[model samples]
Target: MSSELETAMETLINVFHTHSGKEGDKYKLSKKELKELLQTELAGFLDGQKDSETVEKLMKELDENGDGEVDFQEYVVLIAALTVACNSFFWES
Candidate 1:
């Protein structure tokens, strides 16, 4: 059986692929795919946002290669950053 951490890692990869395969490169996420993934998978993080530029900004920041898309490594960086934020929030409370 997979450990919880292993399962979580797998889930991250699966979720990325689910959205990444929808258009353009099958292994990278277009801005639209990133928006859909965020809206569906990370809605709570976006709940306070009031502008559509949020996704645009995220795409800009996460596109580390300046290739106009987010590959899995870039996506993993996002997840890692958010996880750190959540960890801090929980431990601080």
Candidate 2:
């Protein structure tokens, strides 16, 4: 059986692909796909930030190479950032 961390890693990859494949660059997530992914898979994380520009801001921040899309590596950075935030939240609680 896979370790908990391994299962989490696989879930992350699967989630990314599930959204990334919805449009252009089956390997990368377009702005629209990213927004959809966030809204669908991370609703709780986004519920507090009702800003209409949130997705655009995130796209600008996460598109490290400035390629106008989020590749897997860039996507991982976002996941890592969120994970860190979550860790801190738990620690504080």
* Candidate number of the best TM-score: 1
**What is the alpha-carbon lDDT of model 1 when measured against the actual structure?**
0.94
Runs with alpha carbons beyond 4 Å of true place in candidate 2:
none
* Pairs of residues at least 3 apart in sequence or in different chains that clash in candidate 1: none
lDDT tens digits, residue span 1-93, model 1: 999999999999999999997889999999999999999999998998943688899999999889999999999999999999999999988
Model 1 stretches astray by more than 4 angstroms: none
Worst 10 residues of 1 by lDDT: 45-54
Q: 41-91 in candidate 2: lDDT tens per residue?
A: 989877989645888899999998999999999999999999999999999
Query: What local distance difference test score does each model get?
Result: 0.94, 0.92
